[model samples]
Target: MTNPADVKVAVVGAGGKMGTRVSNNFAKSDYQASYVETSPAAAERVKDAGRELTDLETAVSGADVIVLAVPDIALGPVTETIAPMLQQGSIVITLDPAAAYAGLLKTIDGVAYLCAHPCHPSVFLERTSPEQWADTFGGQAAPQEVVAARQSGTDAQQALGDEVIRCMYGPVIDVHWVTVKQLAQLEPTLVETVGCMVGQFLKDVMDHAINEVGIPEPAVKAIFYGHVYIALTNALRGSNPFSDACLLAMDYGREAVIKDDWARIWDDEDLDRVLAKMLRLEKIER
Candidate 1:
């Protein structure tokens, strides 16, 4: 068994908002924090947080786990650069596996490459309006309540819903795992079939409400207008930042919904129930 206190962790891209949050969280942990950031300002932030700011190559030295928090599209190339630098048995996991260059994540004989996404729903909740942020994460919406709800759910047929939820730093409302096969099939279809569809969804929703059929653009804007403000409520209410892997999953989910294509990419029953529950919660909050 590994001792949590003895574990050494490295965080790449430690300068951005998500990076800073992760770095800060690790700084306050019993584990040592080795920070790496391309931005000079991020390097200064690492020093200010009282952590060791090391070059990317040195940061992963002797570490048990390496967290790649870079943009989804850039992960593969970066991993290719660092694969030779890691020790055997090290685990390299990304916050979002959906968009990662999974093919580029070469594994040395003994290393474990796990692509994971964060389950925290509250992180997005933080990007909401200030007036309601307090109550959204306050007394009634405590972490314990979210945890309890998450415990009863399942992401894949292979694991308990609670076990999935428990792997996160904050509340993870739901998750959809992707296999290598699934990623290969879905990637080709995304650009033409999915991305444009999403843009159309946004535009169509706007066109309708401006006059009669759809919800008014003003009202739709108001909803997401609170997104930035409410995103913080998730963590404050006890949810952590949405993991990179989870964000990728959301990208896929949005694509799937827009294309009406739900097959091996995700589990339908689980997703529908989860979405319904989320909508219910939104209605209650509203």
Candidate 2:
């Protein structure tokens, strides 16, 4: 039997928003986590969230499972850095499953990789508390009706993924799985759509709060609804079809809408200052 308790998780983006949430959830869950954030402040935050801290090499080298919580653009380099560091037989998991990343992950030898959630929960307005998110977006099982559809149309693994549609989001739902072959073709559009909507909404919030600068509220609601609903549906569609093309296409569309230049609205020199102000986050660079 697989011992769920034996899982030793290492989170690579412990200092960021999504990393913190993932660290917190894992802390509350039964698994053990070695939280990794390059920033000491982010590392400290992970410790405060009740997880341990370690550098990239040490974390992946000793971990049974490694979770990359970094931004989508950073995944390629980050994964390449850690691939050689990982212990034999260790499994790697990426929150975003875009084809570019999935293709990169497949290049790693002797490690298992899985593409799970495409979007982070903070995008949802309803997710005010970690508990609310834990309860609502936790996990789910796919419906039976989709089973036969998958069986005749695809392979067993593909059908199994289809069976997990129901549990895609709550404590009532369980974790879903898909192969690298499948994940590679999917995930891009889903991440792009979700990330773009959140970015745009955040942009709007920042614009309205230019005077307040850091304290944003209200508009965060629309951001969450539009972002999460769109992402979840795409995830379901991709993971169920056991194909990644549709999701990739969506990501392409979203990227075309808002590329990194969006960060330019705030001058480059003051970008850090702007982010600190908008998120009410204290700069922890020591």
C-alpha lDDT of candidate 1 relative to the true structure:
0.53
lDDT of 2 at 177: 47
Q: What would the per-residue lDDT of candidate 1 be over residues 109-145, giving only the tens digit for each residue?
A: 5565555443233434543444435434322222322
Q: Cα RMSDs of all predictions?
A: 13.7, 13.1
Most TM-score-accurate candidate? 1
Decoy 1 TM-score against native: 0.52
TM-scores of all candidate predictions against the true structure: 0.52, 0.50
Minimal lDDT window, size 10, model 1: 144-153
